[model samples]
Target: MHALVGDAVRKACSELFSVELAEGQLQLQKTRKEFEGDITVVVFPLTKLSKLSPEATGEALGKFLTEQVAHVSKFNVVKGFLNLSMSAEFWKGFFAAALKQDDFGFASPNSAPHVMVEYSSPNTNKPLHLGHLRNNFLGYSVSEILKAVGHRVTKVQIINDRGIHICKSMVAWKNYGNGETPESSGLKGDKLVGKYYVEFDKAHKAQMKALIKQGMTEEQAAQQTAIMQEAQEMLRLWEARDEATIELWTKMNGWVYDGFASTYKSMGVDFDKLYYESNTYINGKEEVEKGLAAGAFFQKEDGSIWIDLTDEGLDQKALLRKDGTAMYITQDIGTAILRFRDFPDLAYQIYTVGNEQEYHFKVLFMILKKLGFEKADQCYHLSYGMVELPEGKMKSREGTVVDADDLMEEMATVAQEVSAEQGKLEGLPEAERNQLFHIIGTAALKYFLLRVDPKKNMLFDPKESIDFNGNTGPSVQYTYVRTQAIQRRYAEAHPGFNPKEANSEGHTLSTAESEVVAKMYEWPAVLRMAATTYNPADIAHYSYDLAKLYNAFYQDHQIVKETDEQARNFRLALTYKTGVVIREAMRLLGISMPDRM
Candidate 1:
């Protein structure tokens, strides 16, 4: 309807005003609540072409649209704006067509070029945390949104499995673990590893305090700490493939990987492939040497390879260290090029890293472009802001970060509490009830993390997220369940009822029904915007608004109880379609909706 009205206004300009509508000249918006039309056309831009006052231009366009556009039933001019209301036939026709479309508001699968999304690139030193939660959810949701809009998406992550961070965990465990494995400790492997990482920090800090008291500077003390030296030596040993070091590294990394798989399952996110810095850094070294040979990078006297990008508004960045070792950026470069090589048809890749790495990616892309990668310009950095709890930002070294597993469990517990208070799951079996709680809890966590703009730092409140009255996940889930409940009641009342069999042409939609249809009508546009921006928050808010509109419509309208079969079936169709859209939109956010929640 928006497109139809915009075209009508353009035609009116060409025919009635003798002007071609150029790009961005035709402006259409939803009419304000007090207006008498479904869409409002801004008349100010058209006034220049019409050679008349805004009011006169609007009046002329309104009259012309009504006469020529079939869906433009009537129009009114208020001040300088033209408000056009669509015909009832137009609204009902779309509703009927939408009901028959199994892929309504979604593009055909794989209609777009292949794209890869890299997210949740966690270091093996620790378990996943609140920050990892946001990263994984955002990346997964963006991948899903792109898929919905016809993109062939590849989900991947480059695990920081080999680093000084992981070495710290290994060193602490070796020195102080007493051979305590995850099984012996009855803890998750990643959690057990994370404990040693924290232990390393504590021991290192205590050593720093003692050294500072012994007439040493803080920096000297930091480097001289025994635990820090142990981690550094462990890293060197692992690099040399020392048998004992390699054995411990493999065993500990195995534990962390097992723990990660479990957490990812509970969080409902998955990857199609995994990349490791241990392997990619080798590729990065080869690439850096090639860049140097091609004059894209230069080597310093100390044997470090660096890319000079001062002309590109970025300073020189090191690709290889003075000791000829790969830096963090080096592995990133390898990972990016490796993905393009792995997926030959990939149009580009999106890196879902935090906002702090904005400069890093800029330099990386610039270097790639300089290195003559044709698709370098097509790459994207989906940088998001840090997530903070009410208590504040998390720190992994201090072990104050909110563990992802513990937080997920807390959310489910909160869901159980909220459901018990409402008495919504009274009759369910224990297993089924538990499933509902998981669904509801996971939805709340994902929705709250995703509802805000991706670039904005957000503070999460667990209690607020579970509230059913506000713009929370539970509220949207409740509305979807309500739609299902309405259909169930209708099905029981009329055992053979089918919304498809009803003749909707005979039904006149009430104002409430019209509003619901209007909200649903915006789904396609909302979905397109989300795909373009790579933001799941767009889909998140759209689901909430659609759910809100449907709940409002259901409050005063009768479906199964209506005397008119045409009206009853029409309302039932509305109910059915609302549930479909809500379910689909939430699914893109990597959230599941329970039927009875």
Candidate 2:
């Protein structure tokens, strides 16, 4: 519809003013609600070509559009805006075309550029928590959106495998566990590792407090703590590949991977490939050496390597420590280089990370460019704010973070309770009921996290997220179920009724039906905007708004018992397509809709 109207408007300019339509002149948007039109074209920019007032330019364009464009049935000039109402024939024609096709608003697979999205990059020392939930959902949804728009997207994550944090867990587990293992303790491996990480912090704090009481300064006590010293020594040993330390590191990291797989499975997110810091840092070290040799970086007297980025308005950043160990940024540099080398056709590499790391990514990209990687400018940081619970902030080192696995289960339990109270799953068997509960539960969880713009800090409330009456996943699911019910009744009553049989030409649509069709017409545009911006919140809102529109139309009109065949079939087709779009939109958000519920 936009293409047809856009071309006509341009043609009108060429014919009327004998001037080419400039790039920014023809701006079209959804007509404001108070206006009686489908779409509005801003005429203020066109006044330059028309040599008339804004209102006069709008009048001329609106007059040309109504006569020249078949879909533009009638139009009005509201000051500088030309509001055009599309004809019923055009909408009905669109409905017929839409009915004949599936995958209506999506582009063909791999038709666009190749891209890579990196997310959920957790360290080996701790289990994933609520913060990881937001990261995983955002990354996964963005990848899905890119795919929907025809981009070949590779989803990946880099595991923070070698670090002092991992050493802390190893030291604590070795000293506290007299050979106790995850199997022996019957705990998830990541949780067990996290428990030990907390233990290391506790013991380090206690030792520091004891030393401080003995007249040492705070900094002196921190460095003198016995457990801290052990962890530091263990980190050095791991870096040197000492057999005992390497064995412990590999075993514990393996445990964490197992635990992470289970959590990711429950969360419905996955990676195409996993990059390990242990491996990538080796590459990063080599790159740093090459950079130092090439004078892109400098080596300090202490043997630490650094990049001077003050000219770029950032301070000098350390690439490697004095001990010649790779810093966090060093590993990132290696990963970026490795990925482009691995996927040579890559158009972009997006890092889905927290807003707190915005400056870190800026430096990383600047450093990548300085290293002479031509594609370094294509790197993007999909920075997002934090997700907090109603209580307060959580601390992973203090053992106060909400575990992802436990939170997912709690959401499922909440779904089950809500379902039972509403009698939503009465006829289903136990197994089916359990599966439905999971779908509804995870839908609630993902929707709540995704519906907010990624740049905003959001408070997540499980109770609010599960409501079927609100602008939520389950509400959209319920609307989908209603669509299915209409089709089922039609199927049951007429035996082989095809709604498309009545897809022939009709009266210019009544006001109610046109409003619904107008919203549907906006789907492709919404998809394009969402894909370009890499935001799932746009799709989330589209689904909710679509569901609301369908519900409003359903309440105001009769579908199964309308005496008019054309109207009934039109309404049925409308309901059916609405369901299709609602399902697809929610699917991109990683939310599943059940047929019955």
Candidate 3:
């Protein structure tokens, strides 16, 4: 539609003003809601060529387009804006064509850029949390959106499985667990391990307090705590591959992996490939040595390797400590290099990380580029804002964070409660009811998190997200279900009804119906914009608007019972197209729409 309008505007200019305008010079936009048109032409850009006032230029172009363009039925000049209303016939044909497409809004797979998205890098010490939920949804949705627009996307995550954090969980579990496994305790593996992590903190804090009571400074006390020292020694032993330490680490991490798999399944997010820090940290150390030999990094007398990024608006950062243990960036550098090597065709590598590490990514990318990895320029830090509860910021060590598993269970419980009150699916089988609740609850969670702009902090409210009337996942899902109900009844009344066989030519549409069709026409463009910005919020809002328009049309017009055959068929076709688009849009956000919710 945009291409058609662009060509019409260029032709109008050439014939009326004898001016040839480049495509970029001819600015076009959707007509403002208050305006009486489907597409708007910015007349101010062409006034110089026409040698007339803006309004006069708009009038001339509008007059020419109305006569020359077949789809453009009429036009009106509002100051410098030439608003053009497309023909009703054009909209009817547009919706009919849409009904024939299986992949309505997605572009065909092509030779576009192959991109890699990295997200959900959870630590093995604890279960996933609300923060991880946001990261996973955003990364997954962005990958899907990219694919929708013809980019080849690879979903990947680098698990932080080997670190001081993991060691903390192991050290506490071994000392105090008494061999309490997940099976014996009736707890998920991640939750069971997290309990020990909290225990470790409590014990370490107690020791620090005792040392402080002995007149030791806080720093001195922190270093002198027995629990802290033991954890540190455990880390050393694990790094040295001590048999006992390795066995303990392996057992605890296996539990975490099992727990994480369940949570990820419940969350409905997945990765195509997984990278482990245990496998990548050694590569990072080797790379650091190579950097040192190449003069890209320097080693101090204390045996710590450092990169001088002071000239890059940052202080020097350590690559390796005196004990030669790798830091966060060390593994990240190694993982990135390994990814590019594994997928040499990758044109972009996006790291979906929290904004707190913005500087870390900057230094990593700069170091990579300095070491002559020219592809480092293609690295993108998709820095998103944090998710905080209404009470306050979360503290993992204090165990205040919202556990992802618990939150999901709560959402399902809330969903079932809301579903029963609404009485929409009461007659379904128990198993189906349970499945619907899971779908709606998970969709609600994903939609609420993805609806906000990625760079903005969001306050998640479980109750608010599951509402049936407002802009939410369930509302959109309900609208789709409503459409399905209409289809079912229509089929009952007219058996063997095939929409493709129904003739919709020359059907006159009411204003509300036309509005619905107009919004549907905007889907492809909205999808493209979402892909370009790498923000699922764009698709989320678009889905809401499309659903809202369909609801309004459903309320104001007749569908299954309309006496007029042409009007009823056209409405059914519109309904069918709306369902397809809603499902597709929600799918791009990693959301599922239940058929009967």
Candidate 4:
């Protein structure tokens, strides 16, 4: 309906005023202050065609809009801007039509293109940290936004389950003397396994220091040559299916998977497909063989496999090690082949990974294109910058890594405390209060992680990130809850308040309410832009704007106290619609709004 009004306004401006209004030239913006009007249209772009000042151009456009646009009630030309007001009758009709539609705020039927988003590729050797949180947030939100805009989206995760890193954990677990298991230690699987990994580094360093004290060369004492030997031994044990080794590995990996599932559930991220490095590494070698046979790659002197990407302005990438084992790039290549074979018509394949691996994806795409996979050109690396703390980058070596599950738990505890302090848990049952805390906590984390542009590095200040006030997720959730509270109060006051019984008549528009209504009308535009740009931050920003406008309206106007019953009911209806939009918007951002928070 808003698009219809904008189109009509554009056509009327072009035909009646001889103003060459380009498509998308005229923007519908809310006035900077409440005193101005609802939807403002800047006519400065038409100054050249009208051969008049901007104020005069605005006056001319305002006249055309009022005279021709049926939905527009009136227009005021103010300082080079045309502030056009929608008739109350138009909003009533708009809401009526919207109520009839089953899928309001969803994209139209013409949007169809399959998008596959890959994220949360955590190594099995360690649990997810703060960085993985950002990756998952972006990936999950992007998928939801695309789905809201009528695109078929597939969320995927690639588990880096096999590598030298896994061997590090395995070596540590083997040499530590104690035959303890995660079940025996009663620690979360990822944390238990991570402890062993840290132990390995400590032991290796101690061994190197001892060797250095014995007057060995620096390189020799560093045990750099022995690192590969130890790694290979671990891999050999793993491949030979040593009973104790396989059992430990399987048990540890099982715990990590279980822990990850819980974390993903709390964060509202799920995968349609999961690719494991263990399953795909051999496949990568097979793909490399195929490429070599097809003249897409060449062999090194030492029996290693490599792909020359110099012609494409990229350095040559190694596909396989001299021992015929797959490397990191090799597994990715195999996965790409498998994915394309599964969904040949996939229009977009986005790898939501850290910015550190930007070059990896660049080379991967180029190699895929060179290997005759045309769909490689459509692949994108949504490279997001690192998430740093106030002090510096998070380093696991320094024991400064923020575990995903631990952070969530801490946030939930803080939310519970805040809820108690606000006396919001007065009559709620213990179970319900706990649930509310969880919801609020999850909302805080998801919103905080997603509010920033995905490509830019961001700080996750523990103190500031968890706050509910001031442009935070809790603020938006509180707005939603406040709207619900108003509806509840109104229902209690007028037990017979039936929406169908009240006619939206004599509902004169106040400046604040009009601004809210105008912003409300642009929900579709926000969704379209977010989906098309594949930027979830756009949705976050729009949701914040809507929340701010609605909160301002609530603060200034008394919906239930209005003398005109019809006006009160009409405002109630607008509040209801705003709640609906807020819920949908937050859902796309992978955040949930509590009914009462």
Best by TM-score: 1
**Ten contiguous residues minimizing lDDT sum, candidate 3:** 460-469
- Name the Cα RMSD for model 2: 2.0
Candidate 2: tens digits of C-alpha lDDT, residues 1-597? 777888989999999899999787789888998998888888888998899999988888889889887879999988888999888778877878877779899999999999999999999998999899999999999999999999999999999999899999999999997887889999999999988988888899999999999999999998989998898999898888899999999999989999999999988898999899999999998988998898899988999999999898889999999988889999999999999999999999999999989999999999998899899899999999898767656766545677799888987888888888888779889999888878888888898889999988888654454454688787888899999998998889888777656653554466777778888888998999999998999999999998888888888898899878777878888888898999999889988888886
Per-residue CA lDDT of model 3 for 456-481, tens digit only, reads 88886644544545888888888999
Clash-forming residue pairs, model 2: none
> What TM-score would you give candidate 1 relative to the actual structure?
0.97
Instruction: Note the residue pairs that clash in candidate 4.
Output: none
**How accurate locally is residue 101 in candidate 3, as Cα lDDT from 0 to 100?**
85
- The alpha-carbon RMSD values of the candidates against the true structure, listed in the order shown, are 1.5, 2.0, 1.7, 2.9
Q: Candidate 2's error at 107, in angstroms?
A: 1.1
Model 4 poorest 10 in a row by lDDT:
222-231
Where in model 4 is the C-alpha error above 4 Å? 1-56, 73-83, 99-102, 108-111, 214-228, 237-247, 463-465, 492-501, 561-563
The per-model lDDT (C-alpha) reads 0.89, 0.88, 0.88, 0.81
Clashes per model (N, Cα, C within 3 A): 0, 0, 0, 0
Ranking by TM-score: 1, 3, 2, 4
